[model samples]
Target: MQSFAKPRALEPLRPLAVHLPSMSYVDVKMRWKKDASFDAVPVLSRARDLRPLVSLARLLSPSPTPVSVVSKLRSSLETPDRRVTSFLRRFPAAFVESVGPEHNLPWFRLPDAAVHLLREERDVFAAGRADVTGRLRRLVLMCPRRRLPLRVAQGMLWHLGIPEDYFKDPDHDIAQDGFRILTSGDGVTCQDDDGRELGLIGDGKGKEMPLSVLQLNAMRKFGSVAKVPVPLFQSKGLRLKRKIQDWLEGFQRLPYVSPYEDFSHINPGSDVSDKRAVGVLHELLSLFVTCSAERRRLLCLRKHLGLPQKFHLVFERHPHVFYLLLKEKTCYVVLKEAYMAGGDTAIEEHPMLKVRKKYIELMEQSQEIIRCRRNRKPIELQSMVSCSGDIEDCTEILS
Candidate 1:
């Protein structure tokens, strides 16, 4: 009979004391260098030292859960020292990347590429890219050599299954409701050749625009990233829009009859029902925000990429139509569904709708897939993660 005993505990987990170097230890080995903006180099350096311990914990300990890491994290936070926090964070990132494929699939591959292209276009216009990159990317880019999250995005794209290069002058404009608008170029908002970013807006029309201007418009932290493509090009018809939307609905298994879209305007003196409708609408907006991205948010961002539970609808421009805008990178999506729900054909009736909330589980848990190769995990096309986030009622590219 084979003996499958505990085997005298292969390796007992050690207190993380030796896991991190003492302050004097670090001081002797390294000095802080002042960078232009952020001073994360030191943190990175510390991560290198602690990494061996973490890897050891993984290999030798009975179990080294994220929870255990979290406990050590709390200890680091409480300690007078701060090196521990950095080690805890970077270690998890490394672990996530290391285990992503072994644990799960990734999105953001080829099949998913079409949606990402569209999203790239949307962010390029509605806001800019780098600004978004700053705020959302932090959480998503956890691992050094990562693949799980991006794989999820790629897989869904394949599963949601759309064509490649769909954003290059898309053949569908049906969603525009019979109108055409286009963006200028990718460089305008960028810091390079053109000037549409960093408050450059445009020279003369686009002047000193860097990457930050979009931050001002998008109202996001990195809104300053100036490079984005916000021009709207007219396509053949609404076929593209219809096809894309239809595909998403089927792919996501969303319900056709939206009860909330209907009752928000009824205002029948019933606060309870109104609130419920509001909640549902809010979910829809989040869905819209993330959905449009396809899998961009999940590909590069995970934590900070969520819809605000609170927002405002301002009738600043188009009369009778209020703008469902976010505080930063303020966005507005089509209010057609809401209008139709309210039994009002007048496009100008309800200009905007606002909502905010807590439970982002649905929007966050959209879909994701991960593919694996030997050393490097290959993110497949069908991988997907929910692209749901805050959505706005954005008009056409040219409105």
Candidate 2:
């Protein structure tokens, strides 16, 4: 024992390499199906070119405005002065063109019908001021800082049912209601004062929150919120492959996350994070009057909503909940449940949409005027030709 060699130093123990199962699911690429009903939503175009007519009408509400002034107000190069003038001319029922006496330039004004429609729209907006403010507040609350830039808010004016004039003096009534406008070097930002979070599920003050489309369907089908809601396909024959369907079933089984809840704890590439992204998008479209928006417009809110860099892929991945329409080279994302079975009518039509329909009806008159003018041209030319022939014959006889 005295002669025993010194015990060799124990080999350093190595930690085991634990391999965690990947929670990420493969994004199965599904073919997009065109739903005529969703495509029928008004102002589906990317540029929403027709909507500018409303703004033009408002600009001329005080008096006839020159094209030069309208051109200057155009912020996007997509809608040039020529396009604006042409669009205004197409809607003769809404816009009236006249020559200015002093400048001798074209001036556009809204007709009586359009003026009445605008007044009706104002009444609708006034009556729904509380609702509008609620939507704007929800949007601000969705942001990480509980604030939204003035430009971002303005970009979503149409979707949020906010009036353009609201920005000019936001501090008046809009800001007085649990909101404040702050100016910094970055620019103006609208911040929430109360700072309460909102969600599609759960309760507040013992009152249950409004359920989402999927939640409502789940309640209707399973008679409980715990079960997975079956997706409503765009068409009758539309069906997902076995693997895709299985993946969707698993996805639906994940605990639903409220869009307004904090997402910091969620793993970025996991299924839960994907579910939260879908929730955020669903909540966003639900707030829109049309329950749809241009894909590009939603891109601006990606960072504000805590979405991933490739967030738009959610729309394509979950085709059952959302429908992506590529019309006029513009991508529009539509909520499937918002529309009726036929997709022609909305389940819950906004009050503003009724007035908008009236404006659209007025706009149709312009096409009729063009058709009449086109049809009358042939008769007028024929009459002129006959008259010229008679004159020539009379001259020959006189000679």
Candidate 3:
């Protein structure tokens, strides 16, 4: 067994080197990066989590899709009627409305800037399709059946730079051998290597993918080894074995503070301590599921993370790094860079996303059944029998 040395003393907590109150948000963000802890979290956008934002953009992409049409489209994703209305009201600058072709119906269209944003997303995806295909193949390989749910899969399309319309085309086969659709009493699911049923997807119970050993430790390690006070400089000569040893040495150095250590002693009124707390919090968040944490949930951990009770202010002070989404009556703090557009894009495929896509696709089929129920009035017995047959045939195709 390898022997480990005792951990070194933790560095004394100090106020930020400079006052952030006088600095702009951008400057504060830039200065925060100078600290070794900047962006320690691996933030990634959850398209499903941000469905209201994404579905709205897609609904209004090409032209003014009718408000009714947009509602129907959003319904496929299980977006609530109130959420749709509220989302529109909250972001008035991104949307505008006009009369539909029928003259009485109102149609919604994205503003010029929003339209341009969609175009940029399209252009980026087109350029990166090959890159996405390779990553997607690897994702399927890791899963048991190479199958995933459509609900979860849809979110990843945006993250992987895959065209939203790609699946609509029967002829386009990027990973034909690795991906497919399955229909069951529950709903439509995607399969790769076709016959394998890995039991990765099921009722709400199986929705969460199994957590990896690496991910589980990422956040926990921060509180264990982040406060060493080695000279804040990189060594040019260190290589492989020595480099690993250096890392071990760094963690064991004097001035240690586990991210989990209590922060009640930190001077909350001082700008410096506040900044350090913010950086630590941000890094802690990176390890969270979905790269997001509910505001209330974070508040509950205030003592454990050494955060102030009014920790919400830290997000406001760094608008460029964090996005606060107020939806479903809960406030969610999302890392801005984890979303689609950023200096480092989400080109990497995620297993959790691959699994969820199937569920979303199943939801799509359920929505179709709902639409059929709502649209069908009284029909003759013979016609009703024929309609049921058609539904069965359609289900097979969707599967």
Q: Per-candidate TM vs. native?
A: 0.16, 0.77, 0.37
Q: State the lDDT of candidate 3 residue by residue for 1-399, as single tens digits.
A: 876988899997778966454312221221122221222321322233345555577767547767775565555555544556545544433556667778677667775545554555555555654555544433333333444445444444544446556666675554442455455533544342343222222322333332222223333444332343211122223233454445335333423233433345555565545555555554444443355656665553454345667777777555445656654465667654445334333223333342233223323433454454467732221111121112122212211
Q: If both were scored by TM-score, which would come out higher, candidate 1 or candidate 3?
A: 3
Candidate 1, residues 1-399, lDDT tens digits: the string is 988876675688899888653221100111112222111222112222322332222222222333334445534233223543333333221222222233442111112222333343444433432332221222222212111233332222211212212222455331222211222364222222222211111111222212211122223433332322111112122233454444323322322212212232332332222223233232222223221121122223221222112212111211112122221232323222222223322111210111101011111211111112222433332222223434423221110
Sorted on TM-score, best first, the list reads 2, 3, 1
Q: How high a TM-score does candidate 2 get?
A: 0.77
- Candidate 2 deviant stretches above 4 angstroms: 1-18, 43-47, 76-82, 102-104, 170-172, 184-231, 341-348, 377-399
Error of 3 at 293 (Å): 9.3
Task: Give the least accurate 10-residue stretch of model 3, judged by summed lDDT.
Answer: 380-389
lDDT, residue 40, candidate 1: 23
Residues 1-399, candidate 2, lDDT per residue (tens digit)? Answer: 387787889897665544543566566788877777655655553235556767777778636878777776666524433566777777665777899878688888776667776777777888877776677777766676666666777778788777776767644465444555455422433243333222212112243334554565567667877764435554645877888878887887787766656689887888888888887887788788777888999998988789999999999888888888887667888877676444332234566666655555555556665665666631111111121112111111100
Clashes of 2: 0
For each candidate, how many residue pairs have backbone atoms clashing (under 3 Å)? 85, 0, 27
Instruction: State how far residue 87 of model 1 sits from its true place (Å).
Output: 19
What is the lDDT of every predicted structure here?
Answer: 0.25, 0.66, 0.45
Higher-lDDT candidate of 1 and 3 = 3
